[model samples]
Target chain A: MSKVSDFFAEFVRRNGATISVYLFTAVIFWIAVLIVLPQLYMLDFSFRFNLPPSKIGTEEDVHTLKNYKYLLFGAEGNPNAFNWLHLEVFFRTIWAAVLVTILNLVICYPVAYYMTQVISGGKARIFILCLILPFWINEILRAFAFRILFGLNGPINFALVHLGIVPEPVEFIKADIALYTGLAYAYMLLMIFPLYNAIESLDHNQIDAARDLGSPWWRIHWRVVIPHAKPGIASGCTMVFMLTAGALAAPQILGGPSSLWFTQVIYQWFYTGGNWPQGAAYAFVLLTACIVFVLTMMRIFRVSLGEIAK
Target chain B: MSADVELDHLTIRFGNFVALQDANLRIPAGSFFSFLGPSGCGKTTILRAISGFLDPSEGHVRIGGEDMAGIPPNNRPTALIFQNLALFPLMKVWENIAFGLEVRRVPKAQRRERAQELLELIALPNQGEKLVSELSGGQRQRVAIARALAVEPEVLLLDEPLSALDLKLRQHMRTELRAIQQRVGITFIYITHDQGEALIMSDQIAVMSQGVIQQIGSGPEIYENPKTPFVASFVGENNAFTGRVASADANHAAVETHFGALRGRNSAGLKTGDQAILFVRPEILQLGAGTQGNALKSKVLAKEFEGFASHIHLANSQGERHISFSTSQEEALNISPGEEATVHFSPDRAIALPLGELAHE
Candidate 1:
């Protein structure tokens, strides 16, 4: 046993540094190929000529810029080709996503701050648990619950009519705005936790000291607490925005035909229209937009998750 | 600049446990006072109560004759320098010093002028724009003081602010702090358990034990005439002889047992048949020959040379009591262990503690 151990130890001693570097490099290489390559492939397809990405799957395929031009401006109304409607659908989805993200921030910030500061101990734990308990259910089931709650003859309209708040029952499911509520509530936990975690970790002594120095409560929160929680707020906003932008199910379920987003369009192109290249190209373009958006927001906020990790 | 703080029958309790009970104190105006006690002795609690962070259950805290009950910490005319210094790490030195004025919504130019003035006063003039994190520990301590003083509080409360510094720095800071207080003329209430700090810096100190103020007096009074046995034992190194009182009067008490009939001062009220403890400082416990007063025939058990003074531990024939002997006399007594020596202490040098429940195990 000693001889074998000695042989292995000597082998490791001779090549430990090189071996460690090789292992790390191998891991990075695997990640780039398996995880990053697929995403990059979608982006490559988006910039390629008006062809679905499935056809371009090869050991080597030089990408092009025609696919983005085709998506931006409709290529001919070819049998299996890009059309002008996809571009419109993409822009509308982007608008809805931005609106959802803004609304999410407006609603989530106060709730997160309240949970962290106004409440504590067991009651706070229970309240937070309730917020996350719904997350245990599948997304489809949660959306279905919202669908039931917002149905024409559901309790909302029933209670509204009883209170004379609204004279007539409103059809909520078919409207695009009604769909955003489902989206917000579905992703509310995501936005809430990061924000609450950020605000929770804020140095409370700093707040108290500011007040003791005679700063008003509003100024204390605005100047000290908010600045300290900026990283948390930005991170939460980023997560919620990305989640909203990537959503495909909510629009398909609650949105009317007029509110069809880019995700549904990609789905229609691939399965219904049997145009893989166009679908892959559109997917790739969306992925690139996400990366660019992340980079831009990080730079704008002057924040890096790396710094936060430290 | 001068406002006295008074605590009348202050009592504070958290849930079922009482932190301070009937804690009464009157800190004179313009005097540097300190609450000197071990940890959890409720000294910091009293400071907090005086500063309005806490409210007594029954009594009231008054500053400059104003009842501070229900007043928030911000509104009270007192500034507290937190133990950790609590200087805003990310803010510039000037910003930290100007925090109090900024909170009050003072104009930027006026506050900056005041901040620069305070920086010079704290001996950190050029460090105005430097970040607080750049300063050393002692500098941070001075910055904390400056920040607290910027509010122009009538009274300043410091809770073990110098407890974090190393020994040499702590000694230097003691003088610096006292000098600053004198220059500023604000009532400084310092809290510390370190005996040397209380001895040198404070104009008056309240020595505490187990949530109660045992004695309050000047440093000399606390060291020389400690009333309680715990105060005597805690304030400095002393050899204590506990025995049943053989005879007692208003002038003197004689303990019949070990250290036999050692006549000490009239310790207020000590009766015969009651137990009594006599305390003698190591410096007062002398060596070399038969002398008057309280003389003990003992043998040198151990002798340790401590540079300036040699500390000799002496034991009697029965070894009933062991007393430390400190002498700067360079006459090397070549005194080995078991060498018989007679130690003497003047009657006036010994203070007798009346046999009471105040004795700690």
Candidate 2:
């Protein structure tokens, strides 16, 4: 406790009282008003029953677990009738998020290695600019661009047909390929930056030493590069997984008629169905699952939260 | 078993710049060879070429009398110890040593046992489980050597691995490395800029300058009989006098200098009227006029007592040429600064050679 006070005292001494007070108050305001209050209100609202307009201030308005139970047994119908549709969407969202994270990792690791290790100086600068230039456009615009690019009559299909690789244009959107591709592309920068930061600090001599000692390239990456980049991998995986799971834009813009995302369900409950409490309940469930997934990944990778934070 | 390495007239070029040029060398099996030079002297380029990290633009590299062209570094039967050691920080000491064996699909038990044996070889017994960061600088250096040896390559290349240690430890490791090389009996190719290290640790030393091998010989031979002005000045200290060869012979020459004509052995065989420089080692120059050989009179500028010996700095009467020589402590007791002195040296101890680039202190 004294250490905490000492830290604040040192901060105040360094920044002066007025600046310290202003900074501390700004942080408090951000936590309490912007973040904590909204989450707490949603949490409280998720537990209460959605009462009718006439039940305002009446005894009928009470806290209940109906919104939570509704996720499992829909509409309070026959007891055995399960809400497998919502459950499946929930699991599918999680599985898709995991797949997207893995896909992004597989694509980003080699690029990050190439950037940090192979090409250097002015070439490295230009490569970074090329990577970040696409992100300068808005995310929605990029998603729509992906949708068009993956369309049946898109340039990709035109190339495939001209090349005689396929007789007919591939239905990429209907096959759910466009959605996965869009999600993977959307969060790719998040994965690459962490991996780049990690791999950039590695000494090039270690690779040479491994090669000199007769290690094959694959074993070199497995035993040296991958182990060294574990923390960055964990950080990237957690960020990509959470953002992909809660992602709404790419799924809505690029998803086909049959594809369903859990976020779309929450959006429907809140605005279309006019049920804020149920929407909050579903959102909270998604957040919990995302947290659980991150923890499980951390356990598997054997990385600490502190290391990821670094 | 060790194998001989031969660089058959190799040259390496980067773009238009020549990093190494038409170098030919033969390193005997189980011998410790060193390439000694200042930075950017192409010593490392030669080492890399032999280790298969680089390919010579011309000629070939042969190991055990077989060409090594097109072979990748991993396929080459050579291991390199980097200057920084480059031990894997994430793995235990044993795991780092066993990494190459693991790549060969060796069983886990045998790998661990081999790692233990290597740890003992480096005198780091029971330190197999500690991370690279846990060891000191010298310990990490030993670990790097042990790791390279664990692969059992025909040859081992070291790129100044002891350059990072303190002076005392560097001297200690020099003897330690020589001992290790003898025990293992592998062809060791060592690269360094320190002449002392090259002289102390190598069975043969190649002195290089500006991507060219200036001279190659045993340490004592190179020190006593340097063929070039660069080698004479670089391998050790020498006071040089610039002059024109007034008289010449097969084995001796008389050079006309500002201090009158001084005679010395003509190692480079300069004819009359040719420019030459006479080099005399400080240890051989004695104070006072001598009855034999060559002598020069100069005014003493300063005298520095260096415990066992005293160094007297002097210049000609015109003060245009500076010369320094060391004397015994008792002999120096009679000398003081600003005194006129005569330094003498036998012609046998001094040599005249064609003028070339001299080493800067």
TM-score of chain A for the candidates in order shown = 0.80, 0.97
| Residue A238 Cα positional deviation in candidate 2, in Å, after optimal superposition | 1.0
Top candidate (TM-score): 2
In candidate 2 the C-alpha lDDT for residue A250 amounts to 94
lDDT of 2 by residue, A1-310 (tens): 9999999999999999999999999999999999999999999889877777888569987888888888888886645677888989999999999999999999999999999989888998899899999999999999999988999999889999999999999999998899999999999999999999999888999999898888888988998899889999999999999999999999999998988899999999999999988999999999998998799879987999999998
Q: What share of the true interface contacts does each candidate keep?
A: 0.40, 0.88
Off by over 4 Å in 1: A1-26, A49-64, A75-131, A156-178, A192-204, A254-258, B315-322, B329-333, B338-340, B356-361
The candidate scoring highest on lDDT is 2
Candidate 2 collision pairs: none
> For residues B1-361, what per-residue lDDT tens digits would candidate 2 score against the true structure?
9999998899999999898988898999999999999999899999899999898899999999999999999999899999888999999999999988988889999999999999998899989989899999999999999899989989999999999999999999999999999999999999999999999999999999888888999999888888899999999778888889999999889888877788888878799999988888888899877988478888788889899899998885369436888999999988888778888888887889898998775
Q: Report the Cα lDDT for residue B76, model 2.
A: 90
